[model samples]
Target: MKLLVVFALTLAYASASVLHGFNSLEDDTNVGIIHGHNAAPGQFPYQVQLISPEGLQCGGSLISHRWILTAASCTEHFDNVTVHLGSIRRSAPRVTYIVSKKDIIIHEDFNRYTVSADISLIRIPYVKYSIHIKAVKLPKIKRSYPSYDGCNANITGWGRTSFDSTHEPEILQYAKVGIISIKDCKKKFGKLGKYIWPSLICASIVSAETWEGDTGIPLVELRSSVQIGISSVDSPKPELEYPAIFTRVTSYLKWIKRHTKLPL
Candidate 1:
């Protein structure tokens, strides 16, 4: 699959380009994984590093014994993928799982232009249970306990340290973000506002950095510990404090259930 994915500032960029402060380059593709403080090992047991022969490409979450959740843009053209789990440090993974291209599933209605339904799932088939790595708790379908509006959440990944930097961090990094309404996000996004769909989730970070390679990372609700969103877009500004977009997890419940037999 030649996934022609690009977004932010100019739609001509590649998968996760540096937003805000830098000029768009030809070779810089991947989502944002910037500005967050380092996370302790096992702090996020559900987190996984999506890797190809080129090294760390994206971040994902362990959703079930045999399933991993991430962005469709990340899995594109990748036939041989290795998932690193049970560790916060990607350089020294405790457990690694392999998956073929046939096992990958991208949302059928996904729009590469608007990045709608940007979610994807990787079928592991046989994941051994362990304390170091586990499935994340999902929010109930009709539950309103965790309000999507202005809720506190987190984003973690091993993306770039800065927009100009080319290296991915060895240790995982995380930052706190607040869920913002689509209306507010639209106002902040300006010309790019029209592309914000109802199916997507919007969030704001005051001073945190989330850049390329951070795509597909989970946005866990602080109070409920349930993953409500997946990292999708970073603001196209240099400040890196603009509202970021996420693929709403609650919107894809049926699609997720259809692929995995988990009681989700």
Candidate 2:
């Protein structure tokens, strides 16, 4: 099945990095553009947790006052979830938090294979809470698509230090890289003969690598920082000295608006 293929490929990409044991992004310099304070500096900004029937501690992005975007795979089914806010260092106890919430929205046509539409938004039913967190802006919806050569793009993840190597990082980790042409990346990966969708963006560094646990991470653009691309899947070819793939946020604004419900 297409769904199974997508899920399997993604699992491979996330598992290649050892530090995370299972969930990891295969490269080290997972890229992004910070809209707020630097994440590594502490980032209680939105204390993110991934909870599923198996366990908790998935991955998420601190995007807005009441929303944290993350992998739809990690949120499809949940018992209880929480989001922590407004601390540079999540290790501190003075952070803000919201518990006993559910996944408020998810992309409909989300294909787990290409990792397209992997984005999801979680909302705290109640407003007043802990940390000084504000909503990170969403990208403007467009009937048009732009190339990476002219757009700002990057990805972020709080995954482990190494691929399947050790414990997950104590603090969130982020990196910055630009989006490249999917045609170039697939061609380099020797898969151009295959399928690279219009929704996917390719990225790489001439001299570095990305790792696991970084899947579902945000690949951001500098112009607005709000114009984001999400890293939903990765390819594992020897050609990828440094390779990355992301889901373009601007392309999905319509889906986001449809799913998000504001207070009455």
Best by TM-score: 1
The runs of at least 3 residues in candidate 2 whose Cα sits more than 4 Å from the true structure, single-residue gaps closed, are: 1-56, 88-90, 93-102, 126-132, 150-154, 205-210, 237-242, 261-264
- Could you say which candidate leads in lDDT? 1
- Per-model C-alpha RMSD: 4.9, 5.7
Q: 220-251 in candidate 2: lDDT tens per residue?
A: 66676664665555553433343455566666
Candidate 1 lDDT, tens digit per residue, 92-160? 888887888899998998755666788899998677767788899886666443338978888888878
Tell me the number of clashing residue pairs for each predicted model: 13, 47
Model 1 spans with C-alpha error above 4 angstroms:
1-12, 16-33, 143-147, 239-241
